[model samples]
Target: MTFLNHRHSSFLRSITQIVTGALLFVAVVSSAKAQDEKPEWKAGSAAVVITPEEPTWMAGYASRDKPAEGKFHDLYAKALVLEDLHGTRMAMITLDLIGVPRSVRENVEQRVEQEYHLAPASLLINASHTHSGPELRSRYLLVKRHDAKWAALADQYANDLEDKLVALIGTAIEKLAPANLFYSHARAGISMNRRLPTPGGVTNSPYPDGPVDQDVPVLIVESPDKELKTVVFGYACHNTVLGLYYYCGDYAGYAQEYLEAEHPGTIAMFMMGCGGDQNPYPRSTKEWAERHGRALANATEAAIIAHRTVVHGPLKSAYDYADLEFAPPASREQLEQDKESTNIYVKLHAETLLDELATSGSINTHYSYPVQVIKLGSEILMIALAGEVVVDYSLELKRRFGNTNVWVAGYSNDVFGYVPSLRVLREGGYEGGGAMLYTSLPGPFTETVEERIYEKIDELVQEVSTR
Candidate 1:
């Protein structure tokens, strides 16, 4: 002002005022827009223990010589129900078991649709795949599923489980009330890639340098008063800590227990991630499992304390099936030859296939796999894929669905077997095609396994996110 002309000084002052006014206007508009987009949710949750009443055959270990001797803790099937403003409801059922058979899923969905009036697409059933949990009945594990007495007991257990799951869903929906949901995550390091490449090929051992997902994604559901009600968290690691005679939920079980203890009267739900190839290291004992569980629970606490994004949701969901092709079954000559092999599992597998061919005349060449996508508010995308999914799917989906929150979950709906990525299939390890020798599946999947799934996910995301 000391040297400037009078008109020039006045012009500069006017320009500064205009720019400041514009910035203030923009900030106010942004605040209003955020308020408009925020969403309110009605949430209800219930937890029920699903452990078998009697000592029964446990799942997940082929080397077990007898039935379960004792139990470290009871297993659970927890349900969370959320209703949007439009009265549309979505229910999530998480189980502490080896896997949910396709039949169980089908029957439960049918009953829920009839009883609760919930759409098939609105319900998601996920299993923890805990190796220590009791074995459910299956038509796939033809090699060594269970003997007559145990099989009968397992069938009865599954029947009772379906009833429990249905009732829990109803209970949660009945308890629905106003709530706020937020999303946050932290990291845990107990899980490592168990498939190691050695001179002998991909061996099931801890490879510290291999790809692993240490993410512990958490969703916090709170009542109107902001009191915590339910906590849903995920980790991409197998529940195989203790392979002892006692039934347990493994590390995932212990993690849930610790969380519930820390926050009394709150339900902690654990959803297994794409952990088909991941395993908790330093495992094989109850103490090791507890250590890993503490690590996971602490990770959840860390995520709960970290900065979180408020989840405003109109709650959109989409579920569909993708037809995945399989390589042709082994020739009849190969089956006959396999029956003479020394490996008992291999022989049993061959005999089962031969019997199937005699009865059905042809083997199934494709599987109709389920894939789901849910949009939370405007930013978060949840991709729930069926199977024991590998880690590549999760990593690749996050990359493809850029600028949005992505959570890819495996072991949902129907967990047929290891759903290998194209890379794993080509690498030709147990997950590739070798494990098929123990199931009714034909063989390794066709090369389109990963592409088909990704395409279906893209389609579902597009469908759900359009609103």
Candidate 2:
């Protein structure tokens, strides 16, 4: 009886040991499988000098009498390429120029698709809209100055820019490596509404009581080793802090410069926000521009140090064009009358329209405005709107998409002219249609401008979210 009991105890102990060992083995296998299946991010960055080598005519300010004499610093075209775990890629290119010309966008887009197999929806191009950058539109130069030399120079610079941009995109793609992304925001009070309300109408001056967007959205990319690689930040103010004859990136350029200097080996890119009707206070001097840049850089640093939401990804993007109808263009008779106006801009605009009528038989009836949406996992939703977008659009979208981190970027893809909200259009200010005199667009967008834009944006948001 004693021998039988001892044998039973030994057998039970052996069985318990086998069961425990098997359980431990299963747990180890499960943890290894989970780590292998986890998703990761990859990112790359590159920048190239884009400032024209010659004395080129400046954009934005039509009253400038001559080409640029010098530059405060060289302008840049920077590219940031991001790839997700599934190998899907997106490229974002930011320029320190006044605007992204349609030609440049088309040229670079076609090349990137052909060379890198990148989809059209995955490319985002934004311009800083600095008033002191070189004017790249040959037609505008021809109409304004009527000098063939100036037009030729503009054409040459544009062609060179197209080549440089294509090469830069390639470099960024080649450098892609393991990375981590974070999204955070801070506010800076540098921008104010420039359309002041008066008894007569809305004038081009700072309005203290008008609506403004001071939110500075930032995206920080770092290596697996926790070294910062790139910082992309945005502000809703015109990069028009200085308008001197010297070529400069204005506040946007200085902001990027300061950030890169403060953090060596890190690339900093600036995206323009909805600041069509906003301007910096105490502008028009180099010192003011630097001060504003420092302020913005400090705000960006604060965001970096603050709590950040990790940006995860199966990255998704959608892009489409909104058919924005135009109001009736100026009649031939009206153009003839305005041709004799004392204001050079008014006269030049009329003459240009007259030439357009002679060439095309009618002014453009509508514009195919571009609208883009990009989703970084479930945490961040970035909307890039073309043209000089007004603050109302940004404010409204933020309210509508309050559940996610919404970053609205204006002056993207195409910067043909001002894009006014329904309120701005109804108010009939410069951003509404008065600024159209400077662009080839015939007149202010119809009231459906805002509706059409929102319709396209909503469609894109739905598409990206579902995907």
Candidate 3:
């Protein structure tokens, strides 16, 4: 990868800002009483800065006309490894970037299983879906024009990222020691439903009254000496506050920064929830991103102070791919007509499918989507679904699970595109079907989308449960 000295004169200023923010964040909360004794759990965490080494094309928003101009803040890939007394272990890696491309996940997964001696199902990877992060794909056939230089930069960045992730997972596990784990949640109204229904149809705009997940779930990990080791938190919203030339992690970055600042030596890991159709309200400005970050941080702070559930060990984990089906492809003549469209994404989408039709004899009708389940004792059940997941999953999964702690994270493993619920698929909006034009996928998922996924979740839940 091309190297640039991004550590400019602003390094000192950035350090000062972090110190100030940490002090402020700490001042905002009263310290909790120390735990009497640590839980019988082993934990470790490690992080690496993944800011693009050089100017490159950024991901998200196809309207941008040029490569990234400069840096707002560096992005990162953080990992947490937890093990129980029974020797069961789980490793989770979180990144401050767009989706985890399938190629990247496949490479990292293979390396992790061979090196770490863990089952393929025990490792989980998530992306923050930050629009301000660097693009990791070598070529985006639909939305981006073919530029060899930009494509090379993206390939180099992706290769470097995979190496970091593989190393980070091992490093975290190597750093493992006795630790405590606790779970709790609070609310933050930073994200609103972006699909507004109108007389015309569901438009992609902020709809305040639509269903949204305001809950900020927090998981605290501390050493036996009562020192905070890591704080894992999640919210259901897209980290798209600033769509500019600079590189940053958006609101998720700010929340982690504030927490780490307030609690020195602590690693704050963010797991994105089902926020496919949600967006940060009053966005497109730095102030709003910071404000939302503060709001989310404050919510986590409140949860940290509230009554908590001690997550016990005997950790159980399961992972598998769900064969999600796409709708039937268009006829050859229809595809030819689509290839002639003025819209590049639409035309290219049709062209790609036409190519697949010629080569594979037909477009792919199903996707090998990733789905995971991890049970912490019999108390918490975590479901990590791939792609940009909508809120209906978090809402309905919780309801169906019947009051146990269910943390459903999106943008995990292989984030190929949007994963809409049956409702959203029926509504037929950007999240529903329109966004498919920007991907190599054949079409929107069929009507059985929600049912098929839930069935798999139930099976995995049974597979990982203790009692």
Q: Write the per-residue lDDT of candidate 3 for residues 1-467, one digit (tens) a residue.
A: 22535675467679899999998877655333234444679999999999988898889988888889988778999999999998778898899999899899889989988999877788889999999988877758223565788888888899989899999999998999999899899999999999999999999899999999888888888788878899999999999999989998999999998888898899998999999999998899888888999999899889988999988877888988777898988888999999999978789888888999999897889888789998887667889999999999999998988678888899999888999999999999899978988888888899988888988898898888744
- Estimated TM-score for each candidate: 0.91, 0.91, 0.91
Write candidate 1's Cα lDDT for 1-467 as tens digits: 58989998989999999998999999999988865643488999999998789888888887887888988998999999998778788999899999878888999999999998998888889899998888775443324655677877888888999999999999998989888898999999989998889987888888888788888989999886678899999999999988988988899999999999999989999999999889998989999999999999999999888998888867899999999999888899999999898998888888888888999998778899999888877757888989899998888888898687788789999987899999889877877778877667777899999999988988898899785
Angstrom error of the Cα, residue 124, model 1: value is: 0.9
lDDT over C-alpha atoms for residue 197 of model 1 = 90
Give candidate 2's TM-score: 0.91
Best of the candidates, lDDT: 2
Q: How many clashing residue pairs are found in candidate 3? A: 0
Report how far off residue 306 is in candidate 3 (Å): 1.3
Backbone clash pairs for candidate 3 read none
